[model samples]
Target: MVADDSKMWRTILKDLLSSEGYDVITAEDGLQAYFKIYESCVDVLISDVIMPGLNGYQLCRILKKDPHLKDMPVILLTGSADSVDRFWSMYSGADAYIEKTSSNALDNVKKILKNFKWKSDMPPQDGKNVFGAVLDELLAETTLRAEISELSNHVEDVDYTIQKIRNLLRSLFGIKAFAALMITMSEMILYSSLKDMKKTEEDLLSRLKRPYFPSYHTYRTIDGKEDVEGLNSIYKVISYDGKEEGVLALWRERSFSVREEKLLSIICEEIGGIFKNIIEVNEYRKNAYLDDLTGIANFRAIEGHLEKLWNSGKNFEISIIDIDHFKKVNDSYGHEVGNEVLAGLGKMLREFGEKHDVFVGRFGGEEFMAISEKSNFLTSVMNEFRQMVEKAHFSQSMPTLSISVSAGVARRDDFSSYTEVIEFADGLLYQAKKEGRNKVISYESIG
Candidate 1:
């Protein structure tokens, strides 16, 4: 029996298995498949994990508990790459778990079927003993537990992090709103519940910014403002690596009891590590796509951006800019000064890209690239940037020093592929250098 929600997968699997000399029966969903399995003399069942009415796990669990069908081979298949699905399939007593996305899916299914010894003596069982209400409740509880367990492993999105934390706390305190203030080495970030609390935020920031003992505290205050007067608050200073770095605060109209305060303290004790992990993960992700020295998008990021635009069939232009006589600058001055020059140029190009509605990145050492939707004045835009680099001072110590850039611009129509466009632009850049340094070369200029 082949059970899948997608008609294409159902047709394909049925045709393949039928060609392999096994009689194939198809159902659009797990519920229909469950009824059909009881009526037909099925040797093995192949079920897709995600289906309407009943999922693969739910169906497998029901079959495994029945006296007659307990020995039947059940193969669970899914297109999902998440590891949690494998765990769930095993927990639900599936005979074998297979990913539909795998190249050897049919081979794996055939292998499992070949090794199975069918218990032909036991007849098919009826659905009279199956309790739908009990099964539904069990599945609901199991799913909720799985989602809560997954929270610790998944922390890629900021909004998801906050929402999950809120959900975790909602049962404990009937949580309405909360706020967090994180202080990293580079910047400070603040998050608050969607409820309007501008005045409350101001008060908390002013009061909590000072140094505090690394512990949770509860306070009841009667400030002049009516909103502030009736509230009770609890806040904890989160410390890691022997230094205070952040704070988490919650407040409500009713005063917090002693038991709730202790629970809050226990929960707050572990939050420091969570916030630290979030900050470190965010930093690592940011550094992965940005150039270390120049703070611009790196080559890998640039390539991804260009590929995305190209795949979308957008009309755009690519501009390649190279610093003239950059090797001489490194030889005359130390690499430290050369780095300063590169950093300054990167910053200037970033600002220029933002102002001109272009995307710019550091292609490599002494070379930067810009991408923009094709415009009639594309050549003039490149010249404007070239002139900016010519006029800018790279270092305050040597105000009289001059720096210039040579550029090449190519439109999307000039080449068949994005890589070819970049190569053509690079050739124009070489032509500019061959004719004279610090020149803007393009198809328009050469033509």
Candidate 2:
């Protein structure tokens, strides 16, 4: 029987356990659960804590004292992330504690049920030494994986590092499921050189679009042959608190063994928190390289984007645009209104970039930039924006006040690098401002 205040979770648990051939029962809360299971012959109890009336802990405590239900084997399902809850569950006389958000919740339930049945239903000397070895192996693997997980906390590029760890574990444990590997961090594909992966990347990407995935889900290919290809691939989602950070996919020609499934499930749990930390670190690094004011990507970001494009052999143009008489506006209208003008200009440039297929960023104060691939289109668009800013009103204080921008454009060349292209545009921009404001200067116009 499963008891919880959350009807959705209750349904989900009911479906999962019922699918495993167990006759399942669900209750809305602990109060309803007690009335149904009290003096009832139940083999196992699955309940959520923090429910109305008697909570799971209280229910477990009461049941433990009852002569008939004392050995029923209560399992407390909780959303708690802290280690303290395990102690509390044990104190309440619960046999097992399962976290609600656990990726392998159903699997954990099966393992718990198996152990309970093994101890209670089976007499001593039945399974004997073999059962003892199975239990010992499970415990040993759990403890070792926990230690490795703690060590992975220090890793930055978790996706890449985990490939090595997976290999090590495969060799150490003599694991058979090894075909191809694909690792991703929040839809950012880190490494995907998997066999038969030309279209597999698309498949893996589609999986990430889902709001959630079971910690371990199998994707079997049914290319109707003579026989069934069971569990051709495994997609392991690494997440924390319902937010996902990464996924590790493993492909194999043969079906997975039962032992490998258990091993991979434990590994997924261990790596989820580590990948979460890795993603957090990457976000922090990216944020540090962005401009605080004007919402412009910093020079470093621009360079990175350019480098990627250049490596891909794509044609692109770089332009530097500067607002005319910006310092005067700041001096006259105070920095506040000047800030409003800069913000307005950034928004305008961003819209134009989006509409015209350009990459826009604030190069610095009083200066902004746009990168585009269209040679004939972007130059005209930048010139048009210069004209628009000149005619548009910024504020009531400056109703009749005019704002103008001078731009210098440069196209990708065989001779010049991305930075060199920017420098060339910067020189032409100097020429535009020096000669006259509110004019667009092409590099062809200068030298």
TM-score of 1: 0.50
Work out candidate 1's RMSD over C-alphas: 18.3
lDDT value, candidate 2, whole model: 0.69
RMSD, each candidate, Å? 18.3, 16.0
lDDT of 1: 0.76
Candidates' C-alpha lDDT = 0.76, 0.69
Backbone clashes under 3 angstroms, per model: 0, 0
**Reference-based lDDT, residue 63, model 1:** 76
Report the lDDT tens digits of candidate 2 across residue range 386-418: 988887776656666668999999877763578
In model 2, where is the ten-residue run with the lowest total lDDT? 219-228
TM per model?
A: 0.50, 0.44
lDDT by residue for model 1 (144-217), tens: 45545466565567557656766666666765556766556454555665244555445555655464332212
Q: After superposition, how far is residue 313 of candidate 1 from its true place, in Å?
A: 3.7
Q: How many backbone clashes does candidate 1 have?
A: 0
Off by over 4 Å in 1: 1-149, 163-183, 187-236, 240-245, 248-270, 351-358, 373-384, 431-447
